[model samples]
Target: MKKYCAYVLLGLAVISNAALAKEAPLVSIPTHDAFFNAIKAHCGKAFQGKVSKDNVGNTFGNAKLVMHVRKCTDSEIQIPFHVGDDASRTWILAKTGAGLMLKHDHRNEDGSFHSSTMYGGHTVDEGFPQVQSFPADVYSKALFIESGIAASTDNVWQMMIYPSRFSYRLIRPAREVQVDFDLENPIATPSAPWGYE
Candidate 1:
C-alpha cells in the first residue's frame, strides 16, 4: 500500500515539526522593568556630579553639581538636579504602560512653575538595563518651538547608571552635554528642589 505509506510519512513529518517547535527556546528582549529597577536600586542617595563633556559651551562652569535620588515610588522616581545654589530643576522618571518617560520639572525661587518646564521625552524602545535614551517627545518639541529654542527639537537625553558611576547626557545635532557622578562616594543630600519645597 504505497498510498497508505505516503499518508503515514506525511503525518509523521508534521508531528515531528510540531515537536521541534515546542522544544525550541523562546528569545525575549530586555524589558523596561529591568531598566527602571536599576535606577530604583539607588533611592535616598545623593551624589555630586561634574560636567564631563560640553561641546556646546560652558553653561555650568565650575558650579557644584549634585543629584539626589530623593523620592521613589512603585511607578516613579524623582531626582533633584542641583547646580550650585540653584535648585530649580528636578528629573522625574515615570514608568508608562508602554515604556518610560523622563520629564524636566523647573521651578522658580518662590516655587512657581517656570514657563518652559515639564519638557522631556519618552522611551521609544526597550532600552538596556544600565542605560536608556529618550528622544524629544511631541510636547517637548512644541515647548521648544514656542520658547524659540527650536534647535532642541532634535534632542535626545540619555541616562546611565552603574555600580561605580552615574551619568546624565544630552545630545543634538551640534550640542552634547554630559555630567558624571561618582556612585561609589555618596554626598550629603541637598535641600529640596524649588517646587518640592
Candidate 2:
C-alpha cells in the first residue's frame, strides 16, 4: 500500500508542474511582434556604422557614425545616432495600437530642442521581421513645410536587421542614404549622448 501511495504522489507532482507551466505565458509577446522584437534584442549594445550609400554629400559621409541602442522599455525605445562628435539626433520607436511610430529627437548641445526637431513617421503596412519602414506622417509633413525643408515632406525612413548587420536608410525622390552597422562586433559604448545622462 505504501508503494502504491508513492506512485500516486509522484503522478500528482507531475500533474501540478504541468498545470503551473500552462498558467505561465510561453512568450512575452505575440508572434506578430517580430520586427519590434528584432530591434529590442540589442537593447544595451552600441555599434559602429559606416555610410554605405550617400547620393548627396553631407556631414554623414564625412563623419564617423555610431548608433547606440540605448534606453528601452516594453513600448518605447530611444536610440541615439552619433555622427563624429555630434550627439544631436536620437531615433525614438514606439509601439501603438495600430502599428509602430518613429520619431526623431534633435537637440542642441545645451539640451534645447532645435527649430526643426521632432519630425518623423509611422509604419503604414505590416513590414517583415527583418525590416520596417515609416512614411512621413501628417505632422511630420507639416513640420517639414513649416521649417522651410519642403523637400523633406516626402521622406521615408527604413530600418533593417540581419544576422550580422543593421541598417538605417532614408529614401526620397532625389536622395537615398543608407548606413550599415556590424552587429556581430559591438564596440565600447561612447560617452553619453548630448542632452542625456
Candidate 3:
C-alpha cells in the first residue's frame, strides 16, 4: 500500500535525523575542560604582572601589579589581582555544566564587598586552551546599569594563559585594557589580598 510505504519512509527519515543529532558535539565540553586544566596547573602560585596595554587612562600604567592563583577547588579558582597597594580585586573562574563563568570580587580595605562587586561575564562557546572570552552576563549587565556604568554592559573580557606569560584583557567598543604577567619568573608572594585575610 502507498500509505504504508509513506509511513515507513517517514520513520526512516526521523531515525536518520536523530542519528545526526547524536553526532554533533556540544559546544562547551572538551575545549573548556582543557583550558580549565591548563589554568589549574598553577594553583597556589602567585605571579607578578605589569600593564601591557590601556587606552582608558594611566590608572595602571605605572603601578606594580600582582596576580595570585591563590585558592583552587574542583569547580572554581580564585585569583587576586593586586595593583600597587590596592588589594580590592579578585578574579574568579568557575566551571559549570553550561560553560565557564568569570566574576570580579571587589572589596574594601576592611574586607567588605563593594557596591560594584561580583560583576562579570560567562563563556558562551568553545574557547582554546590559551584563550577564553567572556561576554557580559545578566548579573554584570544589571550591576552596570545600577551603578551608572552601563557602557560596560557590552564588555568582553579575555584571559590568556601561555607557557611563560599570563594576561588579562578587556575589550569594548571604545575602551581596551590589558595586563601581562611573567609566569617563568614569579616574584615573592605578596600579602593576602583584601578580604582573604
TM-score computed on alpha carbons, candidate 1: 0.83
lDDT (Cα atoms) of all candidates against the true structure? 0.89, 0.85, 0.87
lDDT assessment of candidate 2: 0.85
Per-residue lDDT over 1-197 for candidate 2, one digit per residue giving the tens place of the 0 to 100 score:
99999999999999999988774332323422787778789988999998888888674657888999998887788899999999899999888757788899999878899877778898887787888899999999999888888999999999998889999999999899999999999988877776667
| Alpha carbon RMSD to native, model 2 | 11.0
User: Cα deviation of 106 in candidate 3 (Å)?
Assistant: 0.3
Residues 1-197, model 3: lDDT tens digits: 99999999999999999998774343458878788777888987888887788897786757788999888887889899988888899999998668899999999878989988998898978888889999999989998999898999989999999999999999999899998989998777778877776
Candidate number of the best TM-score: 1
- Please list the Cα RMSD from the true structure of every candidate, rounded to 1 decimal place: 10.9, 11.0, 8.1
The runs of at least 3 residues in candidate 1 whose Cα sits more than 4 Å from the true structure, single-residue gaps closed, are 1-30
Q: After superposition, which runs of candidate 3 have C-alpha atoms over 4 Å from their true positions?
A: 1-28
- Which candidate wins on lDDT? 1
Task: By TM-score, rank the candidates, best first.
Answer: 1, 3, 2
lDDT of 3: 0.87
TM-score of 2: 0.82
Clashing pairs in 1: none
